[model samples]
Target: MNRRVLVPAAVLLSSLSFPLTITGASVALPDLTGDLNASPTAAQWVVTGYNLCFAAFLAFGGSLADLLGRRRLYAVGVSAFLLGSAWCAVAGDVGGLVAARLVAGVGAAIATATGQSSLASAFDGAARARVFGALGTVLGIGLAFGPTVSGFLVDLAGWRAVFWVPAVLAGLALLLCPALPPGRGSGQRVDWAGGALFTFGLGALIWVFVEAPVLGVAHPAVLAVVVAAVAGVAGFVRVERRAAAPMFDLALLGDRAFLGYALVAAAMMGLLVPLLVYLPSYFIDVVGVDPARAGLWMLVLTVPSVLLPGVGAALAKRSPRLLSTGAVLLASVGVVGLVGIGPDGAPWPALLLTGVGVGLTTGVVDGLALSSVPADRVGAAAGLFNTARLTAETVALAAAGSALTLLGGGQPDSGFTDALRVVVVVLGCAGVAAGLGAHALLRRVGR
Candidate 1:
């Protein structure tokens, strides 16, 4: 009805749709792969392509939103997402599906960057915190229930329903796009060189990780790509330092609290999200569970994500260091315990603990990260932080899929369980290290 209601509604709707699509699509993967006769890598691409493009382009999207106008970018993004979803719904093969997903990922990147910056610009002080908390809760709802809802959809309506649902939501958000504020973009020349270098480098890195297992790490091509990726990323940093209007503010990482929040976000993505993406498939292919039941079983792992962000927000205000460190440590511990579960063993106990830790940290980090930066650079801050998080998600997801495939000898059976255990152990160890690093940084900042 008004700017206030329309803005939040549009942003929140977009937020809800993104995670819904992510979780739902993961649940849809097994069915989709079976129907299309896709190879393991192709099936993984259905998710990885989307995340790779999203992570690679987020910096550009954020800078574009700041320069062109957030509302305009938001509209363009939603439109692209709608188009991509429609294409995905009609895709006839894995190649087509992965292509469509890449489009959707780009759109998602733009939508998220613009949507978050728009919200940050619209609210301040306590109101800003509360709105962000609500954002987290909504994200949790989408994530928590996505698998169960998608499982039923896959059973009743087929995996196509997953893409269709997001398309519909994107259309609704588009209708309310006019209510979004026309943000004042600094009319500066965009740093296209920096953007290109970052995208190329990040894309190269992810491709290497995804392909490494399939093509042994010693392969000449993989080695070449690794060298090129390093050079590209290193080149990006150098370009940014000299650019008149850089896409990202490299200096943001200089803030101890900001860096701390970022590490926490990275740990959340790198450690926890892979389980969400891969476990449903494990339940169905290995544990002999139906899709619907697998989705419901996921609730043990997701319910906390839905319930704990509010508590996390409260904790963040009083003791940010504890929240950052405790959240990661708790999840890491759960994951370590998870390594002991057999194929037939109960998973709920470990999942419950992981859920608590993930839930506690959910949406809280975004708000905390943004609050540390200057208001004028909110768009860049939001973009850069999310780039870090999604990059972690993309890399970790790819690595996990690669590990599963290699260890299982391309089968999702008992070998799959063993691989999953190994993967969990590695994630748990890394998460603990990240948690401690985050704690030290936040403590130094007295946050």
Candidate 2:
């Protein structure tokens, strides 16, 4: 097969595995929660742990790809993911599954980081946009069908099958790995200190949020961890400023268009991801639907995401700022509309609207973001932009999970609905602010 076909096939297949695991895990969470008798916090960690590792390791993974080789990193990542998934399939308890997920997340971070970098290395201009659009569409395919597939798997084979499926997908992706170009890296110094500080800092923040609901925020242990988290972040900033080669280009934040793209990317995921994570529970518990039916209802949201990225990319060519701002605003409005949902209320309209808004930013943001910067900074931009996205996703998941646990531990009651309302309103308001902020910055592009 042609290298062209092989490279994308490898990347896209691996991309499919990540979101499949992510969304499928959400569908399987209830089953796992019951089977293992895990606490709400512990159960949330099954998902959060994976995201935390993914977010934390992304910059480092990108750096390793640049230092070692994209193909090598990609191969290593996929292997680790396969192993992690296999471990998850056999895990007997929540702790074991969370540990395995963390390992898989690290591998996912490496593969995804290298996937974007490999594309950036191989393509330029319009071609790059198209490939990324294709990438986003594949991601949508994973997110779109993950739940339905997991539902069937769980119904027939059990929750463990969800993990097994991704493991098999990872194995298939590995076969096409050799088709990737093992291009020489630029030999940039890897910022070990910055990576550690950033990863630990974010992990601490998530820990605080997850535990605060159960253990009082004023608890001595929580207070100490909070202080440590703050210090870790501060230390990361300081190290990045002083490092000969920082993991992130701090100066990139000064670029208005780049900043706009980053904000849009973060907001897009913040609004969409929580729904992907928690909506299954809402359907099964609050709406009294079975897991399979809940997955079908999720199609209203995930289907638009699967279909809209290419459209968004094409529209972006005409007016990027318009697309970015409008898509975010649309999503924000859709989220606000979700506050009125009840067991009796029709959720399709609002979910579809939200999906459309979030979908439009899928491939568009990454392409716009990378193009906004100088060619030399494309790698750093990729790291920072993806880091921003995954960070937002992790934080949002933690916040939403904490809120739900606090409200009713996802009990099929009014409390869960009330908590859901609070989450959506906050997310909606914040998304609106981010959209307007991105628009303002994008409009001031030349200034």
Candidate 3:
């Protein structure tokens, strides 16, 4: 294969593997819970642990790519991920699995932080858009297929089979490693203190979000974590201001276009990520669908995601503001349409619409964010953008899980339905806000 074809193929494979695990694991979670005798909270951690670690390490991973060569770190990340997947397959308990997932999440962080930057470095202008579109297409396929594949594996082999599949795919990615372009280290000093502070601070904050629903927000443990989070984050900002080279360029936050794109991406994930995490369970628990069938049903969401990225890229070229605003509004409509979904309701319509909205907006926002910054800082920009998006995903999952627990009271089924409704409403409102915000920001930029 030519270098152009070979590098993007490798990058996409490496990048798509993590998301496959994310959605696939969600499908496998119920089985894992039963086999491992996990409590609800513990089972939730199987997903949360991955998101938490991935989010925490993203910026650092990107910085590492800039400082240590993208291809080198990409290989390291894939190798670590393969090891983690193997560990998860053999793990005997929920705690062990969650721990293994944390390792895998670190690998995911490194791969994700570098994947787009590498592409940005290799391609420019229209080619960049096409590459991004292709990436989006791959992302859609991975997400679309993940649950169905996991469902079949679980039925035929077991939950462990899910981990094995990704491990195998990652191993293949390793073979293509030589295709990746060589990058010299930037030779800049990394702000270790700032990185540590930000990591701990974000960890503490996520802990509050994850634990607060179980432990009341007013509980002493929660209160203490909140204090630590505030202190750590505040200290991180202070440290960054003084550091010779900060992990994140705080100055980027001032760019209206960048900020707007970041917010839209964050909001999109806030709704979509949790839905992907929880929807499988809903199909099995509430609608009485078999795992395999439920997986097929999820295609309602994944199909549009697969098909729309190119269209989104085209629209973005014409008018990003219109692309973003229209996409968000469409997403809000889709979410709103989901408000009263019940055992008797048809899931495909609402899910397909939401997927279209999310899919379109995601492609455009991704391209916009990459274009918003200077080419040299692509790694840092990718890290910052993804960090925001994944952090929102983590928080959304925690909040949604909490709502299901608290509001469901004694009737677990009913409570879950209620929680889904609440989440849909909130996300719908957020989508509307994002749409309006994008219009305003783009208008200002145009002026």
Cα-based TM-score, every candidate: 0.94, 0.95, 0.91
Compute the lDDT for candidate 1: 0.86
Error of 1 at 46 (Å): 0.8
Per-residue CA lDDT of model 2 for 258-368, tens digit only, reads 999999999989998898888887887778777787788888888877778778878888889999999999999999889988876446788988999988877778878
Over 4 Å off, model 2? 120-131, 184-187, 445-447
Q: List the residue pairs that clash in candidate 2.
A: none
Backbone clash numbers for all candidates listed: 0, 0, 1
Error of 1 at 21 (Å): 1.3
Question: Residue 17 lDDT in model 2?
Answer: 94
Which candidate would rank higher by lDDT, 1 or 2?
A: 2
lDDT to native, each model: 0.86, 0.88, 0.80
- For residues 309-376, could you state the per-residue lDDT of candidate 3 as single tens digits? 77887888888877777787887778877887777644567788888988887566876887988888
Q: Name the 10 consecutive residues with the lowest summed lDDT in model 3.
A: 403-412
